[model samples]
Target: MKTPVVALLTDFGTRDWYVGSIRGVILVRCPRAQLLDITHEVPPQDVVAGAFTLAGAAPWFPRGTVFVAVVDPGVGSDRSLLAARADGRYFVGPDNGLLALALANAKRYAAVRLTNRR
Candidate 1:
C-alpha cells in the first residue's frame, strides 16, 4: 500500500507542545504515515482565516492526502466533527466552516458528521 500523507493545519502556534502532541498521536496510530505541517499560524480561533488558508493550500497537495484542521472556537460544544472527501483528498476537522471553502471548490465531494468518539 502507498504510504498515507497526513497534513495538519491549526491555530496552535509552534511555541508550545500542541503541535508535537498532535504529531505524536498520529505517529502512535499510524507509524508509516507521512505527516506534513500546512501551518500552525492561523490567528487564534479565526475560522475564516483557517478556511481561506486551507482552501488555498489544498490544491497543491497530491491526491489522497488527508488534512486535519483544528481552528474551532467552539470546541467541546455541540458543533459536529466532520470527515470530508473533496477533490480526491480527505479532510478531518471541526464543522465550524473551516473546511467550507475547500469543499466548495471541489467538483465532487462528500462529508459526514463524525459521531464516534472511540
Candidate 2:
C-alpha cells in the first residue's frame, strides 16, 4: 500500500507559526504520512482564492490525498467545519463555500457537516 499524503493550503504565510503548528499536529497523528504544501501564501481571508488554487491542482495529485485548506475570516464564529471527498481526494476546511468550486469537479463526491468541535 502507498503512504498517505496530506497537502496543506492556507493563508497563513510562512512568517507565522500557524502552518507549523498544523503540520506538527498532523505529524504527531500520522508520522509516516507524506506532507505537501499546496501554498501557504494565499491572501488572508480569501476563501475564493484558496478554493480555486486547490481545485486547479487537486486532480494531479495521487488519489486518496487529503487536503487541509484554511482561508477563514470567520474562524471564531459559528462557522462549521467540513469534510468532503471528491474525485478520490479528501478535503477538510470551513463550510463557507471554500470547498464548493473544488468539489464541483468531482466525479464522485460526498460531504458531511461535521459536528465535532475540535
Candidate 3:
C-alpha cells in the first residue's frame, strides 16, 4: 500500500513555468502520483545531464518507479518517444541518443522506442 513515486528529469529551468506545468499535468492525470523533481537545471538542453541525473537516481528508488525525462530539444518533433524497462523500473522519454549511455549496466534490459502510449 505504498504510494508510487514519479522521478521527473527535464531541461526546463526553475524560473520558467514549464516545470510547474508538467507537474500539473501529472497531477491532473494521477493525483496520487508522487512527483519527485530529479532536477530542472539540467544545463538547459543538455541531454547528457538529464540522462545522468535519471540514471543515477533510478536505481536507488523503489520498484515500480517511473523515470520521466524531457531534456528533448526535439520536443513535439518526430523524434519518437520511448518507454524503456530496466532493473525493475520504467523510463519514459524521447529516443534522442542522449540515453544511450545513461544506464549503469546499459545491457540489462530491452529498450523500446514508443511512438504513442497505450
Candidate 4:
C-alpha cells in the first residue's frame, strides 16, 4: 500500500496552533499519511489568493495528492463545503472559488457539496 499525500493550504499562520492542530487530527485518523504544507501565508481569508496559489502549486505535485484549502471568509455561515476531484487529485474546501482555478482546466472533474457532518 502506498502512503497518501495530503497537502494543506491555508491562511492560518504558523504563529498559532491551527495548523498544528489540523496536522494532529489528520495524523490521528491516518497514521501513515504524509502531510505537506503548500503554504500557510495566504493573506488571511483572501480566497482569490488562495485559489491562485493552490492552482499554481497543485500541478507540481504528483498525481493522487489531496489538497485541503482553508481560505474561507464565510466560515460559520450557510456556505457549503465541497469535495472535488480534478484530473487525478482531490480537493476539499469551502465552495467560495478557492478550488475553482485548480479544477477549471481539468480534463476530468467532479464536485459534491459536503452536507453530511458525519
Candidate 5:
C-alpha cells in the first residue's frame, strides 16, 4: 500500500499564516497524511503558473496521492471547488483550470465541480 500524501501548491507565500493554517487543518483531519509542498511561491493570482507547476510535478508522486492546490485571486470567491482523479492521483482545488494539463494527460480521469457547501 502506498503512503497517503497531500501535496499543496499555492500562490500564498510564507509571509503570513495562510499556508501554515491550511497545513494545520489538513493535519487535524488526516494525521498520517504526508504533506509535500509543490510550491508556495507561485506568482500571485497566476492560475496558469499553478497549473503548470502542479501538472509538471504530479506525475512524479505515487498513485493515490492527493493534491490540494490554491492559486490566487479566486480563493474565497463563488468559484466551484473541484475534486479530480487523473492518472490514479487525486486533485482538489478551484475550477480555474489549475488541474487542466494534468487531467488532459491522464489516461483515466474524472472531475466533479463541488456544488454543496455547508
Candidate 6:
C-alpha cells in the first residue's frame, strides 16, 4: 500500500504542543505517513462545530486519507474510540455522537469500538 496521509482535526490550538505531540506519535509509528491538519480551533468542546468542519473538508482529500477527529471532551475515558472507513478514507476519534449525523453523506465501510481491542 502507499504511504498513508493523516488529517488531524482538533480543538487544541497552535500555541500549545498537543497537536505536535499527536504528530510526533504518528511520525514514529508510520515514518512515511503524511500529516495534515484540518483545523485546531474547533470551538472547544463543541462536537457540532467539529462535525461541520469535518464534513466540509473531508470530501476534498484524496482517497484513503486517515482522518483524526479529536474534538473530544471525554477522550481517554469511558468514551470509545471509533474508526470509520468510508468510501476510501479512515477516521479515528471518540464515538460521541458527532459522526453518526454527518456520516450520512459518506459511505461507511467499517466501524468498530476501541474498547473491543484487547
Clashes of 3: 0
Q: For every model shown, what is its TM-score relative to the native structure?
A: 0.97, 0.95, 0.87, 0.96, 0.94, 0.91
Q: What would the per-residue lDDT of candidate 2 be over residues 4-116, giving only the tens digit for each residue?
A: 99999999999979899999999999998899999999998998899899899899999899999899999878999999999889999999988899999888899998997
lDDT of 4 by residue, 33-103 (tens): 99999999999899999999999999898899999999998887888899999989999999899999999
lDDT of 5 at 96: 86
- Give the RMSD in angstroms, all C-alphas superposed, for model 6: 1.7
**Top candidate when judged by TM-score against the true structure:** 1
Clashing pairs for predicted structure model 2, backbone only: none
Write out the backbone clash pairs for model 5. Answer: none
lDDT of 5: 0.91
Q: How many residue pairs clash in all the candidates, one count each?
A: 0, 0, 0, 0, 0, 0
Per-residue lDDT of candidate 1, residues 39-91 (tens digit):
99999999999999999999999999999999999876888899999989999
Candidate 5 stretches greater than 4 Å from native: 1-3
Residue 12, candidate 6: Cα error in Å is 0.8
Please give the range of 10 consecutive residues that has the lowest summed lDDT in model 4.
72-81
| RMSD in Å for all candidates | 0.8, 1.0, 2.0, 0.9, 1.3, 1.7
Q: Which ten contiguous residues of candidate 6 have the minimum total lDDT? A: 98-107
Tens-digit lDDT track of model 3 for 1-118:
5677898888888997888998998899889999998888788778877777777777788878888888888787788887877777888888885555555554576688785654
Q: What lDDT score belongs to each candidate, Candidate 1 first?
A: 0.96, 0.92, 0.79, 0.94, 0.91, 0.84
Q: How many backbone clashes does candidate 2 have?
A: 0
What is residue 118's positional error in candidate 3, in angstroms? 8.7
